[model samples]
Target: MPVQRGYRQACGVARGLDIVGERWSLLVVRELLLGPKRFTDLQQALPGASPNALSDRLRELADAGVLRRRQLPPPGNTRVYELTTWGHDLEPIVVALGTWALAAPPTPEQIFVSADSAMLTIRTYYVPTPDQPAQTLQIDLRDHGPAGTFTAHLTSSGAAVAHEPPEQPDAVLVTTTEALLAAFGDDDVPGLVAADAVITGDADVVRRLLSSVHVPPATDPR
Candidate 1:
């Protein structure tokens, strides 16, 4: 369906597309997933969209009962957009699409996460470390849709990937695909702090691992 789809279509697909079929409409859902956001925050997340388009889409979505405008605490009179109970229903559809795409040929995470300009690398790995030499870390996440693939090399210099359980990764961090990009790309682990991405096998060793596997400063936005 093209961008102009209206609510009058007969088929369910047509009717459904009527809500999120616009160029940047579904992405509006994406920004909201992170949390309720102000209009400016949405604009920053959606760089290509115009303020007018965003306002129109937001208005339409609210009218359709998908999103709702909420007010923040007193003294801070800012308007934020949040998904209604009905809007939360779309999560499964998004996740199913992710699973469906995984069935196709696996190329790279970049292809799946191409929506955002930020190039990210997400990977799941089993790494061996000194503290917990037998542990393994399996990570999965992408900030963008379709998800991306990346290699989490053992950052222990010449130590190489080991087979021991606890001595390996110490902890496994699971998060959305962009966990790495935010940690390593934007160099902002604080962003995921709210989600607590670390999965600990050996708490002590995982602490060290966190410092070791970090992306270089070059990609650090903060």
Candidate 2:
């Protein structure tokens, strides 16, 4: 499909925008950052995007070589959308864009974050220290439809989160995506427990992980 719109500029940023500046385009990229997702999965994660609009964005992205569609084998013969190598390069840009937004007005209290967005937020604010111990935390978002589990590995250098579970986790936290995101801000283990979060391992590890999240002060809009 021919690119629907063009800025007709030689600038790289302008060229980039020509490819992904359309509505819902980058959001599609965000959903696939961790792994491939079927059309239904993207629909669930981005409830606001209309099916037609989403399809258009997907087609445009694929045309731009940002993502590709593939079919799985065996009992799971399903088509899923995943980011291509060039598309995966957008991770830092997406992460940095999110970090930049945190300085603006806080997100409305009523806005619910998808599981992937919540995990990306953790990746955005997580701070690594030279003395911090290496450990893995299994996060189970119980309320998320199709309930998903992710593993977070913390090290002195960085923290990495994946969609798969860890073989041996130092701590396991069971909570809703909303509650988990809230914990990142307050480091409130008791509150999470009160909210019905199940802690199967050392809660301190959870606390330390939560405490290490640093959301910079929001910028005054004056």
Candidate 3:
């Protein structure tokens, strides 16, 4: 497939957009932020994108030095895509954009948020409280329907998500997407527990973590 034409502008923003402004390009970057993923995995994550469109976007990103395709070694010799060092630099930009977009009024229709996206939100919006001690809190966030597990490491510095579980997690919180959304919106611990969200190990750690999330104030719908 032929690559799309650039904006032909000298501005830095325009040049940056020329590389990643294409449809589904940034979404591809978002998916690879956590780790590498096979093409099929990318397809699954981005269900709205057609196969051809996805292929083109990946090609464009790779050409622009945003991502690279490599073959996994030995046991898993399948080809996977991962963000380059420069590509990883886009994390803060994407997080900021997501945070800003959160201020927009909600739509009538439900929005589907992937597990990675949810974890990214937690990482981005987390704020450390002066009262809370600076300790590492590890929590396992599980997506029941998709059956994927993500480990969140919370510290005074910030929060980070990993594909594998922490060797020694301070606590574990297992909940579905719906329950997570509710808890994130209201910081309702009891409500989540009542709804079957399981919390094991030190409950205080989970409490502090939840309390630290900086939810944006409600915006006027009008």
Candidate 4:
């Protein structure tokens, strides 16, 4: 059969690339990975891209079967974009790309990353033992001791709600957004602090949380 213009030649890697090959195409997919989002949510996720372009890319993604629009049920229903089973197939590809980028990082200014991690940096709230009222909050490298890739997981009722190296996060707090995310699965928190990572959030919780979270030797600078 003849290959379609945008369709993957063998429905293999190339085809996968074809579907999400544009500048922000993969980014868009990444945002959707968190959960369903409205049009504005995606726009906010990508700071640089314009609305027209974002809309176009989303349309293309849907056409390629990478995602589909969903509607909420009777309670607090809202229109949102979500990945299909086919869309989920792209996860491995994205993760591989992340691993590759971490292996050899670029300079600081040229670095780029999604705001989700940025929020993870600033917005997340945590308590050290779930018994204390979040004392000893840390933000930026100066506040923390080392510089390296650090991953965090959320817990509730003494059970893990989320953790990294594989699972998605409400947000991923780190030093360098672009390179760090690329290096996340292989993180090292102490080294990240030693390297002067730009960190923000509940310092005490972050310190305690690290013990529970696991990062591969590479991502973690320490």
Top candidate by TM-score: 2
Give one digit per residue, the lDDT tens place, for model 1 in 1-222. Answer: 224647776898878898778777777775564347789767766767899999989988888887899999889799999988888787566545544554455445433343222221112212334543333443433343222222233443312321122224445555554454445423244455556664445443334434444332322222
Q: What is the lDDT ranking, best to worst?
A: 2, 3, 4, 1
Q: After the best TM-score superposition of candidate 2, give how far the Cα of residue 216 lies from its true spot, in angstroms.
A: 2.3
Please list the residue runs of candidate 4 whose C-alpha ends up more than 4 Å from where it truly belongs after superposition: 1-11, 73-77, 115-205, 211-222
Assess the local accuracy of residue 45 in candidate 3 as a C-alpha lDDT between 0 and 100: 75
TM-score-superior candidate, 1 or 4: 4
Which window of ten consecutive residues has the lowest lDDT sum in model 3?
Answer: 138-147
1-222, model 3: which lDDT tens digit per residue? 123677788898888889889888888888889999889888877889999999999988998899999999999989999999999999888877776776776777746667677677677778856554545444444553342577777766777778777777878888776577667645567878998889888877777777777768657645
Instruction: List the candidate 1 regions with Cα displacement exceeding 4 Å.
Output: 1-3, 99-222
- Report RMSD for candidate 3: 2.6
**Residue 10 displacement in candidate 1 (angstroms):** 2.3
TM-score of each: 0.49, 0.92, 0.87, 0.55
Residue 154 displacement in candidate 1 (angstroms): 22
Question: Which 10-residue window in model 1 sums to the lowest lDDT?
Answer: 117-126
Candidate 2: clashing pairs of residues: none
Superposed Cα deviation of residue 112, candidate 4 (Å):
4.6
**Against the true structure, what is every candidate's RMSD?**
13.0, 1.9, 2.6, 9.4
TM-score of 3: 0.87
True-vs-predicted CA distance for residue 98, candidate 4, Å? 0.8
Cα-based lDDT for every prediction: 0.53, 0.84, 0.76, 0.53
